[model samples]
Target: MTRSISLIPSGFPFLDKKWGGIYRGGSYLVIGPRKSGRTLLALQFASECAKSSEVCLYFTNMRPKDLMIQAASLNFDIQSYMNHNLLVVVRIASPSEIYDVPNPDDYLAEYLHDIVAVVNQYKPNRIVFDELTPYIGFRNIDYLNDVFLKTLEEVEDKNINSFFIIGEPATQKAQLIVDTLRHSVTGSILLKKKAEQLAGQFYGGTVIISPNVGHTEGQFTADYIIEPYKGISVEPTIMKTFTRNDSESEERLPELSKIFKPITKIKHENIDDMQMNFSNIYSIEDFHLIINNQIALFKSTGQEFHLVSLKLDSSAILKGLITLNQLKNSVGKSVQKKDKICIVENTILVLIAKTNAHLLNEIIKKIRINLPSRDEVYVKAVTEFIKIYTLEISNSFNNSAELIELILSEEATNAHLTLSELT
Candidate 1:
């Protein structure tokens, strides 16, 4: 019996889309505007979860005792939950109290040490630190980022979820918090007002994420919702593209084919276009290694100058940049044929030779016949990889200084032929 396993956790669109399942294990941030009930929401969630014998720790930099008061207002049973020690409510003097005194950076260092120590000792499944903005204000957002990264290192499993709440008009400082945790936390929920209904009497709250609104135009969107609870109905729930699965993620979106056409070419540009001087004869260089090896055989053993470029499109090269070392080695005998050169235009190009060119070509023709219908398989892969592009460029382009170099490299691959300015 065999099965496919998803390394990603599913069902929660907001967190699932972002951290996949890491938030369940590590930490997360739930951010919204003032009076948006961010704290109330986090407490309600932590309390309700505590009932299931899940140990949680709610560390408050402000009023740890006021949790009962806040919970009472929200109709949450946090007091009873606190009584059983199922939840630990630690009231630090200030959010900054957890850190060292005098020097703000020193405070951050001490605060992170305390946090890690507490989390390790309790090993709680859920941890909620009421508001990080205050701490961030005392020190700096950059320092907070390091704290968050260190905090994530302590996270070991998924069933455990951490919620870090922040009140936001989305300040640069607050944005730094959002951006930092967006990476370290499992998922991020950006709460925004969709629109006002009944002349602004009621409004909708929307949750936007990066991967969900990610489209091919190199545009990533912030998707969310707006609602008045019972009065105003927001279409598509209030989710844009999130890491978690809210109630609305039940229905599946249409297949990739319905949205975008599949790409036939994976690498369209010639090496010359990549600034390689193919015109100038070179003896030994990394780019020419493959051709040089072949040319050497033809020179030393008097083999033919069999130079050929095979057009392997996206499907054939989806595994590009990712080495198929073992897979390629398995087919060594298949690819090593004398007096043969193949050109592939579509992705799945296989040329069989010695005497079976006719048969191989016939088989390939049949596969191409089914290409247009199955184009979506390629489109979806490329789409998800769109987010990974930054990582890919960093790994691939050594010459380029920043992400723009990678963008240019990918664009170079897409454009194939360039203008005089590039020259």
Candidate 2:
């Protein structure tokens, strides 16, 4: 007698039709570089699996709160599933934390034990270990192979579909570990960033490697875009040509300018106070004037600016000008001299001039790390009281007024803008 295989849909109908979803009792690898949408794809899969009434476990190296916020920004209702006990998110220590330990191996062993305990307790139908890089970095090749094989066996025995995510290895030893582990997985998905000449935009592409699935005779590849209020969706217009020698092919698609209105120049008077005060935080009204002027400048020139919004919840203990000043001091250290800060009610806005996604991410990380802790009474970090959102304003906008209106709408709705949405 032969055992029947079970299939779990990836939530996206297109992916299900193309790849036939993921196989239960199988282990898969998801590899990607920074800024790729690998994490979003995995979250979408987990959400879909949970919707089908299957228990799913997600073990992540990021803070659970931060991960929840990211999911919310992508319109993934993971909290509902968690409420019903269909989804469980477990937080694991980051690589820096693991490396700081006196005995890294001992710390990893304890965490492994904890993971096994959680898996046994939940008996989840699906599991995702988002990032095995830290674990692989600490152990030798033989040890890594042993542990990874054991993990595969456990998942197979439990009949759980698992996804092991990792970034592109940086070191030779790390690459070796990834290579050894790749041979043991049932399938692998690779995500890459494709840069386009039109407005220097970046798009994500996915390559699926498996014996069971393909769009044509060779490897399966697809272009994807991340949209606001929606997750990842396939871009059908862009065609990817694979050569016989597997060399890069150049092909031009329809320009984005054809889809959106052409960029127009705007004229505005230079505000005297724009360069007057760098240390002082402005009011929301001043923020409007300054940001509008900056946008006008961006329209005339090709310079870009990033608008960052930090909102505090009503339940937060920290409030008033004191907290705002503390936040400004903390954030001021990380930003450049050209950047400006504003505060209104519970929202704080920062206008950063001339920056890209990677640098912006680093700035945000620095701000989060430098955020001050509250007094003994509150005994909480400032990050606990606030949420951050970023929007990159480029030459794609029709006018400054329209862009400002969108920002106002997003602030009113408490909706956060992500890098993928604007880029």
Candidate 3:
């Protein structure tokens, strides 16, 4: 009987698959902006490997301790792999601590020496160097390339697989990493923070891996939020498609969403995730702002508003933040008092909370009669929008409050609408 082994992706659609085939055995690198989530991404890949084999050497210089802590917190079962004699971890404070970068031959010799020693001693299937970039400095790109090419020559079919991480991309190294992966291993992945976007607010993004890892045929993205449903997880971004060589019945890619979170928490404290808290508001502005933010956050997390509620504080028409004429502009001319309504879409989205929702019935009674046809149409549309989305007008903060609280920060972050996005 002949034995056939096929590469099977974990089918974690919420991750990026830069390398089409898993890093079977060879040196690799991941480069991007600082705190761009390169380490976490590397850990995720390691965790995937830990599931199958033994001995995954995780060597690091910068944040080795923290990386282990984070992996442990995520409940990484490293000990099992350790017991299986499948993993080994080595840390180098800096390349100089281990080898001389000035001498290309020495650097390659050291890299090959240390890795082969670990593989020989432990017989691990994988070896990870988290801070490979520092070992090969900025002054010499060719030195890094030599280390990579020589390291690739060292990997064999029955030998250890490899992975590494780099930080703060420069055009040179980024290209080098890509070139090495193209010729050396199954693939490579890039982890980085997308630049912040200015839309009347300061925002920071979530971690992401390009599905198009090293020019391989795959793509994926995800956005995330701290929703009650998913504690502290990377939001699921949409994925394009996964490609494997022929004989692959189905292709699966890993991906995560890109999200822009608020810089401050001061304003976010007031916002909660329940539908009832904002159920009494009648202000179209607040409604638009809240709803819009929720949608964006959801998109960032790559999720839908499974539960939502919105209300208006029409007290403005009575107290005059908006006059009857302005109301007409919103609703329309054919509407009559107590009988008019309107619903405008493609605008802001906010979860409206008010001191009193019962009062709205009375306020609404007045519009039903005098509302013009246009105003009535808009009001009805808005009502229907709420209804269509399964949004409820809750009387209390009973169920689904945490889910609403989950999205509060996202809404408040961009609470004030930017004219650019609105236009």
Candidate 4:
């Protein structure tokens, strides 16, 4: 007979929405490379589960001290859980100590047995195998598989949810082992470093629901970053577009209408005709054309142009657009006729002729000072919420598509996407 598994919130709206929370007695695989934020993701899951009064256990080969440090860095506060008796952390074996264990064959069996004993003693509601590969890597595949299967059976019998973190497999041998472990899990998520160049190292990957478990089976792509205090932040922009269906698409139309509704609802004489002038504004699509023209002009007359990106709150899109229009008016009054402005989605870009980063900053400062507080047009340089790119005509761009991707990637800035609270 099937039993109802208790569910725990995952703190991250994107994850909880996609995976339907961490279910008790469920096993999940989190696959990623070192520093790809997979560990942080697991810790976030474990912490949230513990917060809900579930007894959560963590088993890792990393030294307890080092694991604690890493957890602390990610704002996990694992120690607090220990204080409340909600968490039990087991340091299976340190990297250096694992190889030094005598009698490799017997050690594996006893080690697995010890972990099972601890689970029996505490009867945790959730469990995590942080870096499961190292524990079974040295043993014979057949022998280790048997032991692993036995361990899974014990956890399953207890109705305890589990998570296994596997390093990004590099070799055929490792891949084979990963496949073996994957077949046993209920669901899996993969995290990988994004190839796109940015100011800092950023990661993007996918979450796939196992066909054997969960309500969904398709793999959904997501972009995330590990923040100093905030931990993992998933981009809501991409997450909103991750899955599409007739029902979801139909629901989104009203939301879109709500944001743009003000454009027609609020009768402002100047704003009414703004839609007609959309053709005059250069779009992100026009990046290559504008850059090439600027380059030709620079080469002939020793002139320069720079691209400045301005973004507003994603959650406050309607308010932001109105603010953007106010900022646009401020910029229109200050900038020369030669300067070009564009609106792509919510962000605004200005192609300033005969300007450098320093001059652009000065102009931005004046715009901010001149902004009327009553208008609510808070416009600032692309330092955090957005990104700015300096374009040089001499710089080689293969095609317009490349330029578009670069500009759109500004959405992947370090700013975290906040979802409306899940009611």
lDDT of each: 0.41, 0.60, 0.41, 0.57
lDDT of 1 by residue, 98-188 (tens): 4334665655555555766777777787777766545444236567677767766665433456777665533454454555556666445
State every prediction's TM-score relative to the real structure: 0.43, 0.55, 0.44, 0.52
Evaluate model 2: give its lDDT: 0.60
**Candidate with the larger TM-score of 1 and 2:** 2
In model 2, what is the error at residue 337, expressed in angstroms? 24
Q: How many backbone clashes does candidate 3 have?
A: 73
Residue 212 of model 4 has an lDDT of: 36
With a 3 Å backbone cut-off (N, CA, C), the pairs that clash in candidate 4 are 25-161
Q: Write the per-residue lDDT of candidate 3 for residues 66-110, one digit (tens) a residue.
A: 443334433454444555655455555443333333554454346
- RMSD of candidate 2 to the truth, in angstroms, is 16.6
Error of 1 at 245 (Å): 18
How would you order the candidates by TM-score, starting with the best? 2, 4, 3, 1
Best model number under TM-score: 2
- The RMSD of every model to the true structure, in order and in angstroms, is 24.2, 16.6, 19.7, 20.9
**Which sections of candidate 3 miss by over 4 Å?**
1-5, 10-28, 62-64, 77-86, 97-109, 138-144, 171-183, 195-216, 219-423
- Cα RMSD for predicted model 3: 19.7
Best by lDDT: 2
Angstrom error of the Cα, residue 264, model 1: value is 60
Total clashing residue pairs per candidate? Answer: 31, 0, 73, 1
lDDT of 3: 0.41
